[model samples]
Target chain A: MFLREFWHKLGSPKWFYQISTGWMIGFAVAALVLLVVGMVWGLAFAPADYQQGNSFRIIYVHVPTAMVAQSVYISMGVAGIVLFVWRMKLADVAIAACLPVGMMLTALALFSGGVWGRPTWGTWWEWDGRTVSTLVLLFLYIGIYALREAIPDITLRGRASALVAIVGTINIPIIKYSVDWWHTLHQPGSFSLTEKPTMPVEMWAPLLVMVLGMYCFAGYIILARMRIEILLREQRTQWVRGLVA
Target chain B: MILRLFFSELRLLSRNKAQVLNPLAFLFLGVMLFSVGVPSTVQSNGIYAGAVLWFIVLLTNLLALDGLFRRDYDNGVLEQILCASEIPFMVILMRIFVHWLHTGLLITLLAPLLGLALGIEAHALPVVMLALLLGTPALSFIGATGAALTVGFSRGGVLLALLVLPLFLPVLIFGANVINDAVAGIDNTAQLYWLAFISMVAFTIGPFATTVGLKISVQLQ
Candidate 1:
């Protein structure tokens, strides 16, 4: 019953707007504190890799952004399903809110990956599986962003983008595996659930901090953007007018 | 009903000879351009030929995709069909089938000639044709979804490419690799199976998505 009530409340933009302020502030503070601690520890204090040395520190940013970028796409796909199946207006808003952030994160991940590559791999880019798949993920984000921009109607735009997101989500695994089969030069992932970390505790700990911080950062940004979008989309509603007044 | 839709689509496409011929011409010219531009030393290898042929086929498929629904949508036939047809799914599926028949199948048939011109060995030529035969249906189906989504827009050409091209990657990867493996005598059955699998997935998902896209587009009108 409590879960059902919360679900119904989640459907209300006014309820969401009223309640999310606390979350937005909490996430913002957590993000700033965690990011500062992670960056300082990882960048300045953490011992460098024996092989790549300082160059490997880029992982502090690269791994987290790449991880979050893919996660954001999956979340958007989930939001797309919610929007389609339940006709949740907030779900569409979540998708719209997630796009620019997801795109930027994907771009950042790619850029950071490239920067890391130049030092370690001795080239700025390689057509390896992970790199190409990440690049494709970026393209998927941009395509959805462009699709949303092209459609003028809000309802149609939401549905169309939702469909594309769902399709992309289905394709993502196929793309990753196919590309992996085609070629692979990038190293196997450093972190996995089944295996222990190859790196020492000092290295993985700050990395963990960075990853958590990035998620908090994303949550904060997405929530803030969703709030602004809700206001713009619901400007004519009495609650919105009341809030504005 | 399916046969009727198929024949009418065939008749309609037969009347527009250019619609049937343009992608073929584009495919031919695209191969020709690649052959002219690349050095002979590079073009001599089967890997290069396989990659070039698959790339051109992908482009040719994209070239034909916009026409998949735009004409019908513009003429109000799409609206009428959606409103009146008992099975719009079959109608849409038939339209995509006819589209694949004209564009993808023609390209597959023409690939051998293009493969030879690009210097694929006689032995590898069959694999080129076979891989394209397995692969192009997926391209047509997936591209049809993008085309359906953007059918309402007048200047959807570039946007359509951006939307559809990334989705084409797996088909392009596996399709090209099949030919490369065949050329190298690597027993390419694995890649062929992958191509077939991707095509099946696309076939299952493509029409349903395209139907939804068409509905959303038609309602916009």
Candidate 2:
């Protein structure tokens, strides 16, 4: 019964707006503080790698962004499933809001990965497993966004994009596995996600902070977009009119 | 009932001999472009031959998928089937099967000729055909979902490619790998097994998703 009421309240845009405003502010401030501290520590205070020297500092941005990129896609998949099963308007909003954020974050991860690679691998792009998977993730994002644009009807667009997103979710694991296999067979001496990082605690701690900061930042952006979507979708409603007037 | 639907679709599709021949012609031209245009020296290398053949097969599959459901959907045939059948999902599955039969299987049958054009050795020809025979059904199954989603749109050709091509990568990777390994005189059994596994999964999930997409398209119309 309590769960039911919570779900009902969640479906209410007005209630969501009231609750998320505080969340949005809190997360924005938290993300800002954490990112600043983490960056300062990682860039200046963290000890340089014995092998990689200061060039290794990029991982503080690279690894965290890469982690969040995958997480954000998974969250969109969950939202897609929720949209189909419950027909909740908020779930659709979540998917709509996450695509751009996920796309940019994935791009950031790829860019940072490339930067890191230039120092470590002697090249800007290597068709390795993680890099190829991230590239595919970017393409999937483009596909979903394109599908949404092609369909004109709002409800139909929601359902169609939702289905595409869901199918993409199922394909992600297979893609990762196949890319990994292809990479292993094609290039024996290459970076892989399975290798254990030998970095010390001091080196990794700031990365932990950066990852948390990035997640909070992504949440704030997604929620802010959700709020704007709510307003746009509900512009003609009495509650929205009263709030505006 | 399934046979009745299957035969009817087959009969209708066979009447339009051009549609059946279209993908085959595309496959032939695509192989000629690569082998003839790129010069013989590069084409004769069995490894490149294997990759080029699989890539051409993938593109040809995409070409054939454009009409998988558009004609039926446009002519009110799909709508009537949905309204009349107790299980409309079978209609989609059968359609995809017939599509694979015409485009995919025929391509597989003709793959040896393309393989020879690319200078693929005798040992690799069987593997190339085997990979296509196993992997192409999955393409049809997956393509059906994209077709169903975009069937409502008047112009869905490029959009369907965007939506479906990324999903085709794994199939392409495994199928190509199967032949590439064979050309290198390595065991390709593992890749073939993975290709079969993917096809099974696509067969199970494709029809259900396509049915849902078709229903949505029909309802929106």
Candidate 3:
């Protein structure tokens, strides 16, 4: 009865599958609204950087995507921890779901950062702290995806890849602080513990909007992917048979 | 018990000449390819050698050690080793030791040619060798962890590199730092000592984590 009770409550794939679509719609609508508004405001209307000119506008995309990349890693790490801690099928599903979403954000970060660099730094690429370390971040994502796809056994692959993601958290501070640590050409953190951000709220407001939008998009994708995973995993269950009928 | 387990691994390593040779050759071939791949400009002559050497070593470590646990896992001997009460932990420790003995030693011994291929000067030979000596054990120990984690998979070598290469960053950084010291005409005794310190730390802590991974792989089967 406890198993049945738990199944009726949290344990059932059918229940999760049923509830997720609602979450996905709410987040998807919110993400679209925020992302569109943020992009229009930042790219067209925001005041230009005194130093960087119009190229500074790229920050709305770069900052949001970079923040999303790192946080998606945390998201994946939590999914991994859940996978191991509870041995939940949905947790594993969540992990596999989030990997690509994390990767897309990493690509966006790298692309926008490179584009931003051209007008500001006068180079196509630089091995400065942020670029090099972010390159390593890209490698970590690729490695996780490649490792999972390359492996045959589902759960072993999941566990092994999770360990990789967890270890990669070590790189987060290194990525953020590599400039300060190495004295590289890249600028130091905009927001400092010892001091406030260099720019006013008018400058950072659009960034906040875009960052929240990216997070919602990330959440929407994970929920959507989890729905597919539940369906595939529960194909043989009675709930699926009833729903299909 | 540890000695017997270690030596048995040594014997197994000695006997499997192809497995041993593939990675050793890869370490050499990878370095050679890099030298030829990059134009032989003046800028390429000095510190570049160390960077290339460390990169090749990381790649070789991945290709070589990817199968570290898979073969034992597939053979089902890992299950026996796990269920065996004589020394479950030591057995896992033995496996790691053997992995190091093969790939790590191979990298150190082969470094001179790789250094030469990369246009390293003769004066820097001792520095490069010493740096490899200082850093390769950590590669083996860390590589063993990656290998153990990925062993149950079908296509693991690339994934192994992905998982293992990030862990190898400090080694690559400090390893390159030591060799760069020589090229820049800086004294590197302190750097080499620091690398040795990190290698010792990796050696001590890496095996237990590897044992956990190995035990899980065996259980899954």
DockQ of each: 0.79, 0.73, 0.36
- lDDT per residue (tens digit) for residues A1-245 in model 3: 88867644555567788877789999999999999999999989889988998888999988888878878887787777666676766767877888888888888888888898899989878877777666777787887888777656777777866666665664445344433333367665554459777787888888789988988988898899888877887889998888879
For candidate 2, the per-residue lDDT at A207 reads 81
In candidate 3, stretches whose alpha carbon ends up further than 4 angstroms from where it belongs are: A1-26, A151-154, A170-183, A192-195, A240-245, B17-22, B25-44, B85-87, B109-130, B149-155, B186-205, B212-221
Q: In what order do the candidates fall by TM-score, top score first? A: 1, 2, 3
What C-alpha lDDT, on a 0 to 100 scale, does residue A179 get in candidate 1? 93
Model 1 alpha-carbon drift over 4 Å, by segment: B41-45
Q: Model 2, B72-154: lDDT tens per residue?
A: 88899889878998888887788899999997899889888888888878878888889989988889988889889988888
Top candidate by TM-score: 1
Which regions of candidate 2 fall more than 4 Å away from where they truly are? A184-197
DockQ value for model 1: 0.79
Interface Cα RMSD of candidate 1:
0.7
Task: Please provide, for model 3 over B1-221, each residue's C-alpha lDDT reduced to its tens digit, 9 standing for 90 to 100.
Answer: 77877788888777878878897878777776776777656566566778788888888777778767776788888888778758677877777777777777767877777787787887888889888888888888877877777776666666677777776776777788778878778998876886687678668757865776776566555
DockQ value of candidate 2: 0.73
Query: How many steric overlaps are in each model, in order?
Result: 0, 0, 0
Per-residue alpha-carbon lDDT of candidate 1 for residues A1-245, written as tens digits (9 for 90 to 100): 99999988999999999999999999999999999999999999999999999998999999999999999999999999999898999999999999999999999999999999999999999888999999999999999999999888999999999999988999999999999989898777878999999889999999999999999999999999999999999999999999968
How far residue B152's Cα lies from its native spot in candidate 1, in Å, is: 0.8
Output the number of the DockQ-best candidate. Answer: 1
